[model samples]
Target: MTSDRARLREENEALRHQVATLRQELTCLEEQMSFLVNLCVASHRLHETADRRELLGILREILNNIVGSEELGIFELDAKRSVLSLVDSMGIDPAGFQSIALGAGVIGHTALTGKTFIAGDGAAPTGTGLEPGLTACIPLRCFGGDVWGVIAIFGMLPQKPALKPQDRELFALLERQAGLVLAMTRPD
Candidate 1:
Protein backbone atom coordinates (compact mmCIF):
# COMPACT_ATOMS: atom_id res chain seq x y z
CA MET A 1 0.00 0.00 0.00
CA THR A 2 1.23 3.53 -0.74
CA SER A 3 1.62 6.06 2.06
CA ASP A 4 -1.38 8.38 2.60
CA ARG A 5 0.69 11.49 1.63
CA ALA A 6 1.77 10.03 -1.72
CA ARG A 7 -1.76 8.85 -2.51
CA LEU A 8 -3.18 12.31 -1.81
CA ARG A 9 -0.51 14.00 -3.98
CA GLU A 10 -1.22 11.73 -6.92
CA GLU A 11 -4.97 12.23 -6.63
CA ASN A 12 -4.51 15.99 -6.41
CA GLU A 13 -2.32 16.03 -9.50
CA ALA A 14 -4.88 14.02 -11.46
CA LEU A 15 -7.67 16.38 -10.46
CA ARG A 16 -5.63 19.45 -11.40
CA HIS A 17 -4.89 17.98 -14.82
CA GLN A 18 -8.53 17.24 -15.38
CA VAL A 19 -9.48 20.77 -14.41
CA ALA A 20 -6.95 22.24 -16.80
CA THR A 21 -8.22 20.13 -19.66
CA LEU A 22 -11.80 21.15 -18.90
CA ARG A 23 -10.80 24.80 -18.83
CA GLN A 24 -9.19 24.56 -22.24
CA GLU A 25 -12.21 22.86 -23.71
CA LEU A 26 -14.51 25.39 -22.12
CA THR A 27 -12.51 28.27 -23.55
CA CYS A 28 -12.63 26.80 -27.04
CA LEU A 29 -16.36 26.17 -26.87
CA GLU A 30 -16.93 29.65 -25.52
CA GLU A 31 -15.13 31.20 -28.45
CA GLN A 32 -17.14 29.19 -30.94
CA MET A 33 -20.37 30.01 -29.15
CA SER A 34 -19.48 33.69 -29.15
CA PHE A 35 -19.05 33.64 -32.92
CA LEU A 36 -22.42 31.97 -33.45
CA VAL A 37 -24.11 34.41 -31.10
CA ASN A 38 -22.58 37.37 -32.91
CA LEU A 39 -23.89 36.06 -36.21
CA CYS A 40 -27.42 35.83 -34.83
CA VAL A 41 -27.24 39.31 -33.34
CA ALA A 42 -26.03 40.80 -36.60
CA SER A 43 -28.80 39.08 -38.52
CA HIS A 44 -31.40 40.32 -36.10
CA ARG A 45 -30.12 43.86 -36.38
CA LEU A 46 -30.49 43.62 -40.14
CA HIS A 47 -34.02 42.27 -39.85
CA GLU A 48 -35.33 44.77 -37.32
CA THR A 49 -34.18 47.90 -39.05
CA ALA A 50 -36.94 50.53 -39.69
CA ASP A 51 -35.53 52.28 -42.74
CA ARG A 52 -37.24 50.83 -45.81
CA ARG A 53 -34.80 51.54 -48.64
CA GLU A 54 -31.86 51.00 -46.36
CA LEU A 55 -33.31 47.70 -45.25
CA LEU A 56 -33.82 46.56 -48.86
CA GLY A 57 -30.27 47.55 -49.69
CA ILE A 58 -29.03 45.73 -46.64
CA LEU A 59 -31.13 42.70 -47.54
CA ARG A 60 -29.59 42.61 -50.99
CA GLU A 61 -26.15 42.99 -49.48
CA ILE A 62 -26.78 40.22 -46.98
CA LEU A 63 -28.17 37.84 -49.59
CA ASN A 64 -25.37 38.64 -51.97
CA ASN A 65 -22.83 38.34 -49.22
CA ILE A 66 -24.15 35.04 -47.88
CA VAL A 67 -25.44 33.21 -50.96
CA GLY A 68 -23.26 34.93 -53.57
CA SER A 69 -26.19 35.21 -55.95
CA GLU A 70 -26.51 38.08 -58.45
CA GLU A 71 -30.32 38.14 -58.88
CA LEU A 72 -32.72 39.12 -56.09
CA GLY A 73 -36.17 40.70 -55.74
CA ILE A 74 -38.85 41.84 -53.29
CA PHE A 75 -42.47 41.42 -54.45
CA GLU A 76 -45.30 43.04 -52.50
CA LEU A 77 -48.45 41.07 -51.85
CA ASP A 78 -51.83 42.48 -52.79
CA ALA A 79 -53.70 41.48 -49.67
CA LYS A 80 -57.11 41.84 -51.21
CA ARG A 81 -56.28 39.76 -54.27
CA SER A 82 -53.48 37.82 -52.63
CA VAL A 83 -51.16 38.66 -55.51
CA LEU A 84 -47.47 39.51 -55.40
CA SER A 85 -46.36 42.73 -57.06
CA LEU A 86 -42.81 43.84 -57.54
CA VAL A 87 -41.87 46.50 -55.01
CA ASP A 88 -38.11 46.56 -55.37
CA SER A 89 -35.26 44.33 -56.38
CA MET A 90 -31.61 43.93 -57.43
CA GLY A 91 -29.84 42.25 -60.38
CA ILE A 92 -33.11 42.06 -62.34
CA ASP A 93 -35.00 44.62 -64.38
CA PRO A 94 -38.20 45.60 -62.53
CA ALA A 95 -39.62 48.18 -64.94
CA GLY A 96 -41.29 45.51 -67.09
CA PHE A 97 -42.18 43.02 -64.34
CA GLN A 98 -44.07 45.12 -61.85
CA SER A 99 -47.75 44.29 -61.11
CA ILE A 100 -47.15 40.59 -61.57
CA ALA A 101 -49.63 38.33 -59.77
CA LEU A 102 -48.84 36.10 -56.82
CA GLY A 103 -50.09 32.51 -56.52
CA ALA A 104 -49.83 32.59 -60.28
CA GLY A 105 -46.32 31.19 -60.58
CA VAL A 106 -43.26 29.95 -58.66
CA ILE A 107 -42.98 32.98 -56.45
CA GLY A 108 -46.66 32.46 -55.72
CA HIS A 109 -46.11 28.87 -54.67
CA THR A 110 -43.31 29.87 -52.31
CA ALA A 111 -45.32 32.73 -50.80
CA LEU A 112 -48.52 30.76 -50.48
CA THR A 113 -46.78 27.79 -48.88
CA GLY A 114 -44.52 29.93 -46.73
CA LYS A 115 -41.56 27.68 -47.47
CA THR A 116 -38.57 27.26 -49.79
CA PHE A 117 -38.77 25.48 -53.14
CA ILE A 118 -35.91 24.20 -55.32
CA ALA A 119 -36.22 25.02 -59.03
CA GLY A 120 -33.27 23.31 -60.68
CA ASP A 121 -35.18 20.45 -62.35
CA GLY A 122 -35.69 22.50 -65.52
CA ALA A 123 -38.73 24.11 -63.96
CA ALA A 124 -40.05 27.02 -65.95
CA PRO A 125 -39.64 30.52 -64.58
CA THR A 126 -42.55 32.00 -62.65
CA GLY A 127 -43.87 35.50 -62.00
CA THR A 128 -40.63 37.40 -62.46
CA GLY A 129 -40.54 36.22 -66.12
CA LEU A 130 -36.80 35.59 -65.79
CA GLU A 131 -34.97 32.41 -66.74
CA PRO A 132 -34.81 30.07 -63.79
CA GLY A 133 -32.07 27.88 -62.44
CA LEU A 134 -31.67 27.14 -58.76
CA THR A 135 -34.08 29.62 -57.24
CA ALA A 136 -35.40 30.18 -53.73
CA CYS A 137 -38.50 32.12 -52.75
CA ILE A 138 -38.82 33.26 -49.14
CA PRO A 139 -42.15 34.43 -47.69
CA LEU A 140 -42.26 37.89 -46.24
CA ARG A 141 -44.76 38.47 -43.44
CA CYS A 142 -45.59 41.90 -42.13
CA PHE A 143 -47.30 43.17 -38.96
CA GLY A 144 -49.96 40.90 -37.44
CA GLY A 145 -48.95 37.91 -39.56
CA ASP A 146 -50.04 39.63 -42.76
CA VAL A 147 -48.20 38.21 -45.75
CA TRP A 148 -46.70 41.33 -47.27
CA GLY A 149 -44.22 40.11 -49.86
CA VAL A 150 -41.47 37.70 -50.79
CA ILE A 151 -37.77 37.95 -51.55
CA ALA A 152 -37.10 35.89 -54.65
CA ILE A 153 -33.51 34.84 -55.32
CA PHE A 154 -32.34 33.07 -58.38
CA GLY A 155 -29.28 32.14 -60.41
CA MET A 156 -29.02 31.59 -64.16
CA LEU A 157 -26.50 28.77 -63.99
CA PRO A 158 -26.89 25.97 -61.52
CA GLN A 159 -24.89 26.50 -58.36
CA LYS A 160 -22.33 23.86 -57.59
CA PRO A 161 -23.49 21.68 -54.68
CA ALA A 162 -26.95 22.57 -56.06
CA LEU A 163 -28.79 23.98 -53.05
CA LYS A 164 -27.76 24.07 -49.42
CA PRO A 165 -29.40 24.42 -46.02
CA GLN A 166 -27.43 27.61 -45.51
CA ASP A 167 -28.92 29.03 -48.71
CA ARG A 168 -32.41 28.51 -47.39
CA GLU A 169 -31.53 30.07 -44.06
CA LEU A 170 -30.02 33.09 -45.75
CA PHE A 171 -33.12 33.45 -47.93
CA ALA A 172 -35.32 33.35 -44.89
CA LEU A 173 -33.28 36.11 -43.31
CA LEU A 174 -33.64 38.15 -46.48
CA GLU A 175 -37.39 37.61 -46.44
CA ARG A 176 -37.73 38.84 -42.87
CA GLN A 177 -35.71 41.94 -43.59
CA ALA A 178 -37.61 42.63 -46.79
CA GLY A 179 -40.95 42.51 -45.02
CA LEU A 180 -39.85 45.00 -42.39
CA VAL A 181 -38.56 47.34 -45.06
CA LEU A 182 -41.65 47.06 -47.28
CA ALA A 183 -44.00 47.76 -44.42
CA MET A 184 -42.19 50.95 -43.64
CA THR A 185 -42.20 52.14 -47.26
CA ARG A 186 -45.58 51.07 -48.68
CA PRO A 187 -48.41 53.58 -48.36
CA ASP A 188 -51.07 52.79 -45.77
Candidate 2:
Protein backbone atom coordinates (compact mmCIF):
# COMPACT_ATOMS: atom_id res chain seq x y z
CA MET A 1 0.00 0.00 0.00
CA THR A 2 2.86 2.40 0.86
CA SER A 3 4.57 1.80 -2.48
CA ASP A 4 1.28 2.27 -4.33
CA ARG A 5 0.59 5.56 -2.55
CA ALA A 6 4.09 6.88 -3.46
CA ARG A 7 3.57 5.90 -7.06
CA LEU A 8 0.21 7.66 -7.16
CA ARG A 9 1.74 10.86 -5.68
CA GLU A 10 4.49 10.85 -8.31
CA GLU A 11 1.97 10.38 -11.10
CA ASN A 12 -0.18 13.20 -9.73
CA GLU A 13 2.80 15.55 -9.61
CA ALA A 14 3.71 14.64 -13.19
CA LEU A 15 0.18 15.32 -14.34
CA ARG A 16 0.21 18.69 -12.58
CA HIS A 17 3.44 19.63 -14.36
CA GLN A 18 2.03 18.62 -17.68
CA VAL A 19 -1.03 20.75 -17.07
CA ALA A 20 1.12 23.76 -16.17
CA THR A 21 3.23 23.36 -19.28
CA LEU A 22 0.14 23.15 -21.42
CA ARG A 23 -1.18 26.35 -19.90
CA GLN A 24 2.03 28.19 -20.71
CA GLU A 25 1.96 26.96 -24.27
CA LEU A 26 -1.65 27.97 -24.62
CA THR A 27 -0.88 31.50 -23.43
CA CYS A 28 1.93 31.85 -25.94
CA LEU A 29 -0.26 30.58 -28.74
CA GLU A 30 -3.00 33.02 -27.79
CA GLU A 31 -0.55 35.89 -28.00
CA GLN A 32 0.66 34.71 -31.37
CA MET A 33 -2.88 34.41 -32.65
CA SER A 34 -3.64 37.92 -31.51
CA PHE A 35 -0.59 39.25 -33.29
CA LEU A 36 -1.54 37.35 -36.41
CA VAL A 37 -4.99 38.90 -36.35
CA ASN A 38 -3.43 42.34 -36.11
CA LEU A 39 -1.19 41.60 -39.07
CA CYS A 40 -4.10 40.35 -41.12
CA VAL A 41 -6.16 43.41 -40.35
CA ALA A 42 -3.32 45.76 -41.21
CA SER A 43 -2.66 44.04 -44.50
CA HIS A 44 -6.32 44.07 -45.40
CA ARG A 45 -6.58 47.75 -44.62
CA LEU A 46 -3.51 48.67 -46.64
CA HIS A 47 -4.95 47.14 -49.77
CA GLU A 48 -8.51 48.20 -49.11
CA THR A 49 -8.60 51.39 -51.18
CA ALA A 50 -7.20 53.05 -54.27
CA ASP A 51 -7.98 56.64 -53.37
CA ARG A 52 -4.89 58.51 -52.21
CA ARG A 53 -6.58 60.44 -49.43
CA GLU A 54 -8.44 57.39 -48.24
CA LEU A 55 -5.27 55.33 -48.36
CA LEU A 56 -3.46 57.85 -46.26
CA GLY A 57 -6.30 57.85 -43.80
CA ILE A 58 -6.16 54.08 -43.52
CA LEU A 59 -2.39 54.25 -43.11
CA ARG A 60 -2.88 56.76 -40.33
CA GLU A 61 -5.31 54.43 -38.64
CA ILE A 62 -2.82 51.58 -38.86
CA LEU A 63 -0.12 53.76 -37.38
CA ASN A 64 -2.39 54.86 -34.59
CA ASN A 65 -4.12 51.60 -33.79
CA ILE A 66 -1.60 48.89 -34.61
CA VAL A 67 1.80 50.55 -34.50
CA GLY A 68 1.04 52.30 -31.24
CA SER A 69 2.48 55.55 -32.51
CA GLU A 70 0.75 58.84 -31.99
CA GLU A 71 3.28 60.89 -33.94
CA LEU A 72 4.46 59.83 -37.38
CA GLY A 73 5.39 61.22 -40.77
CA ILE A 74 5.18 59.61 -44.17
CA PHE A 75 7.74 60.94 -46.63
CA GLU A 76 7.75 60.37 -50.34
CA LEU A 77 10.94 60.07 -52.34
CA ASP A 78 11.21 62.55 -55.16
CA ALA A 79 11.39 61.32 -58.76
CA LYS A 80 15.04 62.42 -58.81
CA ARG A 81 15.70 60.45 -55.62
CA SER A 82 17.48 63.44 -54.10
CA VAL A 83 14.99 64.43 -51.47
CA LEU A 84 12.40 63.07 -49.10
CA SER A 85 9.49 65.41 -48.60
CA LEU A 86 6.95 65.12 -45.88
CA VAL A 87 3.77 64.15 -47.66
CA ASP A 88 1.60 63.38 -44.65
CA SER A 89 1.91 63.43 -40.90
CA MET A 90 0.00 62.87 -37.68
CA GLY A 91 0.24 64.08 -34.12
CA ILE A 92 3.18 66.47 -34.57
CA ASP A 93 4.43 69.63 -36.21
CA PRO A 94 5.50 69.02 -39.80
CA ALA A 95 7.48 72.25 -40.04
CA GLY A 96 10.65 70.59 -38.80
CA PHE A 97 10.48 67.73 -41.30
CA GLN A 98 9.39 69.60 -44.38
CA SER A 99 12.10 67.96 -46.39
CA ILE A 100 15.21 65.84 -45.95
CA ALA A 101 18.03 65.30 -48.39
CA LEU A 102 19.03 61.75 -49.11
CA GLY A 103 21.64 60.43 -46.66
CA ALA A 104 21.45 63.48 -44.43
CA GLY A 105 20.14 61.99 -41.22
CA VAL A 106 18.41 58.93 -39.81
CA ILE A 107 15.37 59.45 -42.03
CA GLY A 108 17.49 60.06 -45.09
CA HIS A 109 19.83 57.21 -44.23
CA THR A 110 16.87 54.87 -43.95
CA ALA A 111 15.67 55.99 -47.38
CA LEU A 112 19.17 55.68 -48.81
CA THR A 113 20.01 52.25 -47.41
CA GLY A 114 16.60 50.64 -47.00
CA LYS A 115 17.45 49.91 -43.39
CA THR A 116 15.20 50.43 -40.42
CA PHE A 117 16.72 52.59 -37.68
CA ILE A 118 15.21 52.46 -34.26
CA ALA A 119 16.23 55.06 -31.72
CA GLY A 120 18.38 54.44 -28.59
CA ASP A 121 21.07 52.65 -30.57
CA GLY A 122 23.56 55.50 -30.95
CA ALA A 123 21.59 57.02 -33.81
CA ALA A 124 20.03 60.49 -33.69
CA PRO A 125 17.93 62.62 -36.01
CA THR A 126 19.90 65.43 -37.57
CA GLY A 127 19.88 67.92 -40.46
CA THR A 128 16.97 69.97 -41.79
CA GLY A 129 13.40 69.20 -40.67
CA LEU A 130 14.42 66.29 -38.46
CA GLU A 131 14.67 67.86 -35.02
CA PRO A 132 11.64 66.18 -33.54
CA GLY A 133 12.53 63.22 -31.31
CA LEU A 134 12.10 60.26 -33.62
CA THR A 135 11.42 56.79 -32.35
CA ALA A 136 12.13 54.88 -35.57
CA CYS A 137 12.57 55.15 -39.34
CA ILE A 138 11.20 52.32 -41.51
CA PRO A 139 12.14 52.22 -45.13
CA LEU A 140 9.33 51.36 -47.52
CA ARG A 141 10.91 49.05 -50.05
CA CYS A 142 9.46 47.87 -53.31
CA PHE A 143 9.95 44.51 -55.01
CA GLY A 144 12.93 45.58 -57.09
CA GLY A 145 14.85 46.35 -53.91
CA ASP A 146 14.29 50.07 -54.19
CA VAL A 147 13.24 52.18 -51.24
CA TRP A 148 10.75 54.80 -52.30
CA GLY A 149 9.41 56.13 -49.06
CA VAL A 150 9.96 56.20 -45.33
CA ILE A 151 7.67 55.92 -42.33
CA ALA A 152 9.09 57.80 -39.40
CA ILE A 153 7.67 57.20 -35.97
CA PHE A 154 8.25 59.99 -33.53
CA GLY A 155 7.97 59.30 -29.84
CA MET A 156 5.69 56.26 -29.79
CA LEU A 157 2.46 56.78 -27.93
CA PRO A 158 2.69 57.63 -24.25
CA GLN A 159 1.51 54.15 -23.30
CA LYS A 160 4.26 52.48 -25.30
CA PRO A 161 7.66 53.46 -24.02
CA ALA A 162 9.61 51.38 -26.54
CA LEU A 163 9.18 49.14 -29.52
CA LYS A 164 8.63 45.47 -28.95
CA PRO A 165 9.98 42.54 -30.95
CA GLN A 166 6.50 42.12 -32.36
CA ASP A 167 6.50 45.78 -33.32
CA ARG A 168 9.57 45.15 -35.44
CA GLU A 169 7.78 42.28 -37.13
CA LEU A 170 4.83 44.56 -37.84
CA PHE A 171 7.21 47.20 -39.19
CA ALA A 172 8.73 44.65 -41.47
CA LEU A 173 5.29 43.80 -42.76
CA LEU A 174 4.63 47.48 -43.39
CA GLU A 175 7.93 47.86 -45.19
CA ARG A 176 7.05 45.02 -47.48
CA GLN A 177 3.41 45.86 -48.12
CA ALA A 178 2.90 49.61 -47.74
CA GLY A 179 5.05 50.62 -50.70
CA LEU A 180 3.41 48.21 -53.08
CA VAL A 181 -0.01 49.37 -52.01
CA LEU A 182 0.98 53.00 -52.48
CA ALA A 183 2.38 52.32 -55.90
CA MET A 184 -0.78 50.57 -56.96
CA THR A 185 -2.94 53.32 -55.52
CA ARG A 186 -1.02 56.22 -57.03
CA PRO A 187 -2.78 58.17 -59.80
CA ASP A 188 -1.14 58.26 -63.17
Candidate 3:
Protein backbone atom coordinates (compact mmCIF):
# COMPACT_ATOMS: atom_id res chain seq x y z
CA MET A 1 0.00 0.00 0.00
CA THR A 2 2.88 2.41 0.76
CA SER A 3 4.51 1.64 -2.62
CA ASP A 4 1.19 2.38 -4.34
CA ARG A 5 1.00 5.79 -2.66
CA ALA A 6 4.60 6.64 -3.75
CA ARG A 7 3.87 5.70 -7.37
CA LEU A 8 0.71 7.80 -7.40
CA ARG A 9 2.59 10.77 -5.98
CA GLU A 10 5.25 10.49 -8.68
CA GLU A 11 2.54 10.39 -11.35
CA ASN A 12 0.91 13.47 -9.93
CA GLU A 13 4.20 15.35 -9.92
CA ALA A 14 4.85 14.43 -13.58
CA LEU A 15 1.40 15.56 -14.56
CA ARG A 16 1.91 18.87 -12.77
CA HIS A 17 5.20 19.43 -14.62
CA GLN A 18 3.54 18.72 -17.95
CA VAL A 19 0.76 21.18 -17.18
CA ALA A 20 3.27 23.90 -16.35
CA THR A 21 5.17 23.34 -19.58
CA LEU A 22 1.97 23.44 -21.60
CA ARG A 23 0.92 26.68 -19.94
CA GLN A 24 4.25 28.29 -20.83
CA GLU A 25 3.88 27.20 -24.44
CA LEU A 26 0.39 28.64 -24.57
CA THR A 27 1.63 31.96 -23.26
CA CYS A 28 4.31 32.14 -25.95
CA LEU A 29 1.78 31.38 -28.64
CA GLU A 30 -0.51 34.14 -27.41
CA GLU A 31 2.33 36.64 -27.56
CA GLN A 32 3.19 35.67 -31.12
CA MET A 33 -0.44 35.95 -32.17
CA SER A 34 -0.64 39.40 -30.68
CA PHE A 35 2.47 40.49 -32.56
CA LEU A 36 1.09 39.17 -35.83
CA VAL A 37 -2.20 40.98 -35.30
CA ASN A 38 -0.33 44.20 -34.65
CA LEU A 39 1.64 43.73 -37.83
CA CYS A 40 -1.55 43.35 -39.81
CA VAL A 41 -2.97 46.51 -38.30
CA ALA A 42 0.19 48.42 -39.09
CA SER A 43 0.05 47.27 -42.69
CA HIS A 44 -3.51 48.47 -42.97
CA ARG A 45 -2.61 51.82 -41.49
CA LEU A 46 0.24 52.27 -43.95
CA HIS A 47 -2.07 51.57 -46.84
CA GLU A 48 -4.63 54.05 -45.60
CA THR A 49 -2.17 56.92 -45.20
CA ALA A 50 -2.96 59.65 -47.74
CA ASP A 51 0.33 61.50 -48.02
CA ARG A 52 4.07 61.23 -47.46
CA ARG A 53 3.90 62.96 -44.08
CA GLU A 54 1.17 60.63 -42.92
CA LEU A 55 3.12 57.68 -44.18
CA LEU A 56 6.17 58.80 -42.28
CA GLY A 57 4.11 59.13 -39.15
CA ILE A 58 2.73 55.63 -39.61
CA LEU A 59 6.22 54.28 -40.12
CA ARG A 60 7.32 56.03 -36.98
CA GLU A 61 4.43 54.52 -35.09
CA ILE A 62 5.31 51.02 -36.26
CA LEU A 63 8.95 51.39 -35.31
CA ASN A 64 8.18 52.91 -31.94
CA ASN A 65 5.28 50.74 -30.83
CA ILE A 66 5.93 47.48 -32.66
CA VAL A 67 9.67 47.16 -33.17
CA GLY A 68 10.44 49.03 -29.95
CA SER A 69 12.85 51.37 -31.72
CA GLU A 70 12.75 55.12 -31.82
CA GLU A 71 15.73 55.90 -34.07
CA LEU A 72 14.87 55.40 -37.73
CA GLY A 73 15.46 56.91 -41.14
CA ILE A 74 13.65 56.49 -44.44
CA PHE A 75 15.64 57.22 -47.55
CA GLU A 76 14.17 57.32 -51.01
CA LEU A 77 16.28 56.06 -53.86
CA ASP A 78 16.97 58.46 -56.69
CA ALA A 79 17.94 56.24 -59.57
CA LYS A 80 18.71 59.18 -61.86
CA ARG A 81 21.30 60.55 -59.45
CA SER A 82 22.33 57.19 -57.99
CA VAL A 83 21.81 58.61 -54.55
CA LEU A 84 19.61 57.86 -51.59
CA SER A 85 18.00 61.06 -50.39
CA LEU A 86 16.62 61.18 -46.93
CA VAL A 87 12.85 61.57 -47.04
CA ASP A 88 12.18 61.42 -43.30
CA SER A 89 14.14 60.63 -40.18
CA MET A 90 13.99 60.68 -36.40
CA GLY A 91 16.45 60.25 -33.55
CA ILE A 92 19.39 60.75 -35.94
CA ASP A 93 21.15 63.60 -37.67
CA PRO A 94 19.57 64.19 -41.07
CA ALA A 95 22.39 66.35 -42.36
CA GLY A 96 24.96 63.61 -42.01
CA PHE A 97 22.78 61.26 -44.12
CA GLN A 98 21.12 63.65 -46.47
CA SER A 99 22.41 61.87 -49.53
CA ILE A 100 24.13 58.49 -49.56
CA ALA A 101 25.66 57.07 -52.71
CA LEU A 102 24.60 53.71 -54.00
CA GLY A 103 26.70 50.90 -52.44
CA ALA A 104 28.39 53.34 -50.06
CA GLY A 105 27.21 52.30 -46.60
CA VAL A 106 24.61 50.00 -45.08
CA ILE A 107 21.79 52.07 -46.57
CA GLY A 108 23.53 52.22 -49.93
CA HIS A 109 24.43 48.55 -49.91
CA THR A 110 20.83 47.58 -49.24
CA ALA A 111 19.58 49.99 -51.90
CA LEU A 112 22.09 48.63 -54.41
CA THR A 113 21.66 44.95 -53.63
CA GLY A 114 18.02 44.76 -52.51
CA LYS A 115 19.26 42.78 -49.51
CA THR A 116 18.36 43.46 -45.90
CA PHE A 117 21.27 44.13 -43.55
CA ILE A 118 21.21 43.44 -39.83
CA ALA A 119 24.01 44.65 -37.63
CA GLY A 120 25.92 42.11 -35.47
CA ASP A 121 24.79 39.38 -37.86
CA GLY A 122 28.33 39.42 -39.34
CA ALA A 123 26.82 39.92 -42.78
CA ALA A 124 27.35 43.66 -43.17
CA PRO A 125 30.65 44.52 -44.82
CA THR A 126 33.11 46.86 -43.17
CA GLY A 127 32.28 50.57 -43.58
CA THR A 128 28.69 49.69 -44.29
CA GLY A 129 27.67 53.01 -42.73
CA LEU A 130 25.71 51.38 -39.95
CA GLU A 131 25.50 54.04 -37.31
CA PRO A 132 27.08 53.65 -33.89
CA GLY A 133 24.08 51.88 -32.37
CA LEU A 134 21.96 50.91 -35.36
CA THR A 135 20.69 47.37 -35.56
CA ALA A 136 19.01 46.72 -38.93
CA CYS A 137 18.73 48.07 -42.46
CA ILE A 138 15.85 46.92 -44.66
CA PRO A 139 15.44 47.59 -48.35
CA LEU A 140 11.97 48.77 -49.24
CA ARG A 141 11.02 46.90 -52.39
CA CYS A 142 7.87 47.64 -54.32
CA PHE A 143 6.12 45.21 -56.61
CA GLY A 144 7.96 43.80 -59.66
CA GLY A 145 11.18 43.29 -57.70
CA ASP A 146 12.23 46.92 -57.57
CA VAL A 147 13.65 48.52 -54.45
CA TRP A 148 12.41 52.08 -53.97
CA GLY A 149 13.93 53.00 -50.62
CA VAL A 150 15.67 51.91 -47.45
CA ILE A 151 14.61 51.92 -43.82
CA ALA A 152 17.47 52.25 -41.35
CA ILE A 153 16.63 51.00 -37.88
CA PHE A 154 18.88 52.17 -35.12
CA GLY A 155 19.02 50.77 -31.59
CA MET A 156 16.27 48.63 -30.15
CA LEU A 157 14.63 49.52 -26.86
CA PRO A 158 16.40 48.39 -23.76
CA GLN A 159 13.69 45.83 -23.13
CA LYS A 160 14.37 44.39 -26.55
CA PRO A 161 18.14 44.04 -26.46
CA ALA A 162 18.31 41.67 -29.45
CA LEU A 163 16.30 40.76 -32.48
CA LYS A 164 13.89 37.86 -32.32
CA PRO A 165 12.09 35.76 -34.88
CA GLN A 166 9.03 37.99 -34.60
CA ASP A 167 11.17 41.04 -35.28
CA ARG A 168 12.44 39.44 -38.50
CA GLU A 169 8.87 38.70 -39.50
CA LEU A 170 7.90 42.31 -38.90
CA PHE A 171 10.81 43.47 -41.03
CA ALA A 172 9.73 41.20 -43.86
CA LEU A 173 6.21 42.56 -43.63
CA LEU A 174 7.49 46.12 -43.76
CA GLU A 175 9.75 45.32 -46.68
CA ARG A 176 6.82 44.08 -48.70
CA GLN A 177 3.85 46.15 -47.55
CA ALA A 178 5.58 49.47 -46.87
CA GLY A 179 7.15 49.45 -50.31
CA LEU A 180 3.85 48.86 -52.00
CA VAL A 181 2.21 51.64 -50.03
CA LEU A 182 4.98 54.10 -50.84
CA ALA A 183 4.99 53.22 -54.51
CA MET A 184 1.28 53.72 -54.82
CA THR A 185 1.38 57.07 -53.07
CA ARG A 186 4.59 58.48 -54.55
CA PRO A 187 4.10 61.44 -56.87
CA ASP A 188 4.96 60.95 -60.50
Leading candidate by TM-score: 3
TM-score of each prediction:
0.65, 0.85, 0.94
Give the alpha carbon lDDT tens digit for every residue of 1-188 in model 3: 99999999999999999999999999999998899799889888988867978998999889888888888899989989999998888888888888999889777888999988888777675564446776899999888979999999987889988878788888998898888888787888
Cα TM-score of candidate 2: 0.85
Q: All models: lDDT?
A: 0.68, 0.85, 0.87
Task: Name the candidate, 1 or 3, with the larger TM-score value.
Answer: 3
Per-residue C-alpha lDDT of model 1 across residues 50-158, encoded as one tens digit per residue: 7777777767776665566678777888868777788777778777557656566778766676665666545544544453543777788777766678777776334
Cα lDDT of candidate 1 equals 0.68
lDDT of 3 at 116: 88
Comparing 2 and 3 by lDDT, which wins? 3
Candidate 2 local lDDT, 75-147, one digit each (tens): 8888585999887899878887888888888888889888898887785556445445778889987768688
Ranking of all predicted structures according to lDDT, beginning with the best and ending with the worst? 3, 2, 1
Question: What does candidate 3 score on TM?
Answer: 0.94
Give the 10-residue window scoring lowest on summed lDDT in candidate 3. 123-132
- What residue runs in model 3 are displaced by over 4 Å at the alpha carbon? 128-130
List candidate 2 segments past 4 Å from native.
1-10, 120-132
User: What lDDT score is found at residue 137 in candidate 2?
Assistant: 88
Name the best candidate (by lDDT).
3
